[model samples]
Target: MSFRFLPDDPVASIKLRPGQTVMVDPSARRGGSCLEVLEGVARVYCPCEETEGMTLAFLQEGDQVRTDRLCSEGICVEALTPLSFRSDAEPQEGVGFDSVNEWTLQLLRIRHLGNAELRLHALLALLVNRLGRRCGQWCDLPFRITHDRIGELIGSTRVTSTRLISKLRNSDQLDTPSGDNNLRLSAALIESAPVLG
Candidate 1:
């Protein structure tokens, strides 16, 4: 397998202080170039068909975010903390970038899942698989994500997300260990999420 990472010679490099936002237009991706995070956290807002407006994803270091039609009407990348990133405005073939492609495809699949609540569960499961830290059959998602953030990501209202989160928590599929804001996900429960009816 062959792949190309984002260009080292980025068209632009920017530093954002916490709470700042950058709006990226489709024109910025004219050459197939995209944005890659170098440090800190970015909260991405991309419009989705299932959304009345946009959906959100909290990306951390090494996350690649598309600046193309995948975010029709463009997208916003907000700095949750101090952030540094680069954009490769000039397109390059992603020859061996299977991970990036797979990441995008997985999100797309989650966005199009037939069941809304199932989609949310699946998204959490996917996140666990991609980003969780293993601990004796449990996976810790080392990110501070609130029910409101979950709502934004899954295209539901805050109240709804909060309720759903409580339900999932009660069901033993997800947990928050004492003194830790990070979510702990059950590996067995994540595997069983898809078949949940």
Candidate 2:
């Protein structure tokens, strides 16, 4: 849960190791400044005292998070993989898409599902579709998220998420091998997610 404050000076780029978090203070930047991911993946989350660590979005290479539109307290970006991003990007014209907003909307939708299992399934499908890639027979997510974080994402308790994850493992739908940082999900499991239908 430890995090460092983003430097107020405008730097060309910043890099972070996996699990490192830096808080972005919108008030410290220009009106339309943005951060453009140069490489790797990051989990963007709330930094406000009330909602600290609540993930708002996941950004990967080429994705951008607009500072002007963030909460007054700004947000925190946690390196999910070896991450690098430009800190002094100008706002692009005519690109109405906001990765944070889109992810927030989708996450909200998943939370509204009736059952925790459904929510977990939908969450996996969404993550795989948005941030993972198909391998020979499984979809591989570049980074691993903890069960507690998964529970937070799906609006469930950690114990419930662990139970559901165990079920998936027993069914051969999920694989997290020791010594590997990736999460391998069966293609069938991703395809069968009701949220994707």
Candidate 3:
């Protein structure tokens, strides 16, 4: 029987059995691709010569990003780990891409611009709410990212992303715990920033 994959179900094609791992290839575009669960579980990795081996996004069973492309700039995606899954079953529902594609488009707009303006943060905050995985109050994801990748994806460099994150934090626009690799943002934090408009 075909498995009916739900919206936001445990991302399959991963969480495999013991000693199994799949080598997910680089996505044609960022954020979304048809991953092959050849071994165990997989994480999205972005290839950055500088960061060594860091990721920029993460997906569990049933997770898909940018299935729809809303921007002119193509999405950048790579696998973080070798993963595996049961590929025998067929999905009842077609892989949905609406929400993620919308988020990608909005983020593309933010990156294309030079600064992380207020309205931009507003949208990003929403996108984060919808796209990010929640660990208690903190929303997190593995964005195997680098300075250059951030700049390219958001139309800026690692330095720019870092500065913006710092600025947002200093202004109480975000909350990323000290020494944590990911940035966690709340609605209030993002909204507090001065509107770029």
Candidate 4:
């Protein structure tokens, strides 16, 4: 079942309970490797050259990342939910890399080049498009995203992200259902952000 994410490829799968973390360090001597989240959400953090520090990229079920060459710095992936994952030493073929790479690149571009508001908007739209599940006219973003995580995604301070989120809520662009960590994004809000469409 877990091997479905890396179909037709030799792989090893493991289960990670919530809050577990795995380090992926590829070496030429051991060949390349790929990591795929078969279930649950995982946060992948890598060293960012531009930021001169670390940056986070969140992955949901069916998403995978790989390094064909040696990873000098390596990547740290932490499970946000009870996660099933796999690691492959043999080169992967036909895996879902295009969408994952595009998504990562787009966020990096926004983080590096976009204004605070634009970055915030782009990140929200991305969440809706990538991790959201449709619920009526709203899309449910099933994550407990703190202002700090939002700030990390947008390259801003937590205060700034809090202000933006407050503004969004006041403007009726974002909403949270009572007693749930999941966020509900209005369809109108999704349409308004060009990044989301």
Q: For residues 71-139, what per-residue lDDT tens digits would candidate 2 score against the true structure?
A: 898899999999999888886788777888999999999998999999999999999999999997899
TM-score of 3: 0.47
Each candidate's number of clashing pairs is 3, 0, 35, 0
What order do candidates take by lDDT, descending? 2, 4, 1, 3
Segments of candidate 1 deviating more than 4 angstroms:
1-20, 26-32, 47-53, 56-60, 66-72, 80-83, 88-92, 96-105, 111-117, 177-181, 195-197
Model 4 misplaced regions, further than 4 Å: 1-11, 47-53, 89-91, 94-100, 112-114
- Write the residue-wise lDDT of candidate 4 on 1-197 in tens digits: 01111233435777776556665554422444566677888777664355433544778876767655324766666666678877763445776454446666877877864588888877787777777877777878876677887887889999999999999899887897788767888877776665532
Q: Tens digit of lDDT per residue, candidate 3, span 30-71? A: 333333234422433333345443333434444444332322
Which pairs clash (backbone N, Cα, C closer than 3 Å) in model 1? 2-96, 3-96, 31-91
Clashes of 1: 3
Q: Candidate 1 on 1-197: residue-level lDDT in tens?
A: 11122233455677887667766766535545678787876766654445543445667777776565445566677776678888863334564653345655666677677756877888788777766667887887765576776675666678888788888789887888887657888878677667322
- Please say which candidate is ahead in lDDT: 2 or 3: 2
State every prediction's TM-score relative to the real structure: 0.65, 0.96, 0.47, 0.77
Order of candidate numbers by TM-score, starting with the best: 2, 4, 1, 3
lDDT of model 3, residue 16: 37
What lDDT score is found at residue 130 in candidate 3? 41
